[model samples]
Target: MQPLACRSCGNTVLVAKSSLAHTSVQWADSSRCVEFALAGSLTERAVVSGCTALRASIEDAVRAGRIEVPAE
Candidate 1:
């Protein structure tokens, strides 16, 4: 997993890309994510789709070759 920080909110998460369509994220602390924090509770955060900021950051990292995916 590669450590990636969200460009918008700066929360760092461990990311692993298995394929272009598959991504796994491990958050050190879900509460540390500003977007998740705004939801006010862990349950709320769980219901939330995900952090768009972090999604964008991961995409950028993949495009920039910072995160490598294995062959299909």
Candidate 2:
């Protein structure tokens, strides 16, 4: 497991590959409430960075008119 800094609280939290697939994000504690499961070699930093980058890329694409923004 690897420690990842939370974007909202800046707290270093562990994010396992198993949790990414099965865990549910909680807003109360801002952390995972499950145990880690063995899987592919992915560090917490890598997962967080990938998630952040993906979100940014999607946002950028939407802003640049490369993607459509859905109306609420």
* Overall lDDT per candidate, in order of appearance: 0.88, 0.36
Candidate 2 structure quality by residue, lDDT tens digits, 11-50? 4444323321232222233233121212233454234423
How does each model score on TM-score? 0.90, 0.31
Top candidate (lDDT): 1
The TM-score measured for candidate 2 stands at: 0.31
> Per-residue lDDT of 1-72 in model 1, one digit per residue for the tens?
989988887778899998999999999977777778899977788898888889989999999999998889
Ten residues in a row with the worst lDDT in model 1?
Answer: 28-37
